[model samples]
Target: MVKKIEVEGYNALIECLKENNTGTVFVHFSGSLDENGVNWCPDCVKADPVIARNVDKAPEDSIFIHCHVGPKAYWKDQNNDFRQDPKFYLRCVPTLLRIGSPQRLQEDQCCSDDLVQMMLEETEENVTPRY
Candidate 1:
């Protein structure tokens, strides 16, 4: 089974990655939820369920990290840590990336069930290492 972790903001995400950097680590970045538990980004709302349904496709023992970027205001800030961070440099919400690899799906791609499943099920041999 895949192990999952939930984190809010860039700091917590960094911390989580530090400890769970091994194996197949899938990091999902999405907008923060409101009091009603709904994401601020419409794309994220659509992608959430699709990603959840396909989570089981990930390799066993894989670590999946769901990270809430921040409120709308924070995310809109040009200097937000997520945007400034070299490793991430995220430009949009609902981004899914495999840690230590170049595999990633952004924006509308995250809502595609087939793409999400393919990403999750991708084996190490299929991933080309980053330089």
Candidate 2:
């Protein structure tokens, strides 16, 4: 079964990562809504169910995180760490990444079931070191 954890901000998400560093982790970034309850990024909304459907392909011990990066006003800020943080450097909403691994699916790629499965099931040999 896939364990899903929802986080609302960058610091909270980072803290969760630090505590769960050993096992497999799938991280996704998406834009959140304001008091009006409207999602800013349509892509993120579209990717949600696909991510839910494919998350079970991950290892048994793996964890999945759905991170809400805040409203459009926050994400649109050029100085946002969501775009500047090297660990993430997220260029788009609905970006999915395998923690401690190089596998990542961006933009429309995140909707591909095959690619998401491959990212979740990537073996040690298949993971190319980032640096």
Candidate 3:
């Protein structure tokens, strides 16, 4: 089953992490929403608690994604990796799954039905399982 958090906007990503599920979420920031005023990056701000709770868990792969804002990069590997938007960040569940924490999904405006369909085109190249 897909587990998720209902948040208002992409800016609200951090708040979703603060919810009760208690797991690491990776963020990808690559757009015009200004992060300068937010003090700490939303992804970093939210990761503190999740990291604290996951002390003894699998440390290597449990990180959530939070990329820098503004013009993004094309992160495709020569290994046929599924490429996501420069701004596309994710909270891949396997790490959480390995540590026995449920995956925490946050609703994004870009996560519209259209985007969902468009994104699925990468399924064959999926390095990780998505909901």
Whole-model Cα lDDT of every candidate shown, in order: 0.93, 0.84, 0.31
Winning candidate number (TM-score): 1
**Candidates arranged by TM-score, highest first:** 1, 2, 3
**Worst ten in a row by lDDT for model 1:** 85-94
Residue 72 of model 2, lDDT score: 90
Candidates 1 and 2, the one with greater lDDT: 1
Q: Tell me the tens digit of each residue's lDDT in model 1 across 1-131.
A: 99988999999999999999788999999999998988999999999889989998999999999999999999999999999987887899989999888888999999999999999999999999977
- Candidate 1 positional error at 106, Å: 0.7
Model 2 bad stretches (over 4 Å): none
Best candidate (score: lDDT): 1
The TM-score measured for candidate 1 stands at 0.96
CA error at residue 19 for candidate 1, angstroms: 1.5
Clashes by residue pair, model 1: none
CA-RMSD of model 2: 1.4
Candidate 3: C-alpha lDDT: 0.31
Which ten-residue region of model 2 has the weakest summed lDDT?
A: 122-131
lDDT of 2 by residue, 1-131 (tens): 66789999899899988987877788988788768786789997788778778888888888899899987988889888788888887888889998766678887988888888888888666778787
The local lDDT score (0 to 100) that residue 88 gets in candidate 3 is 32
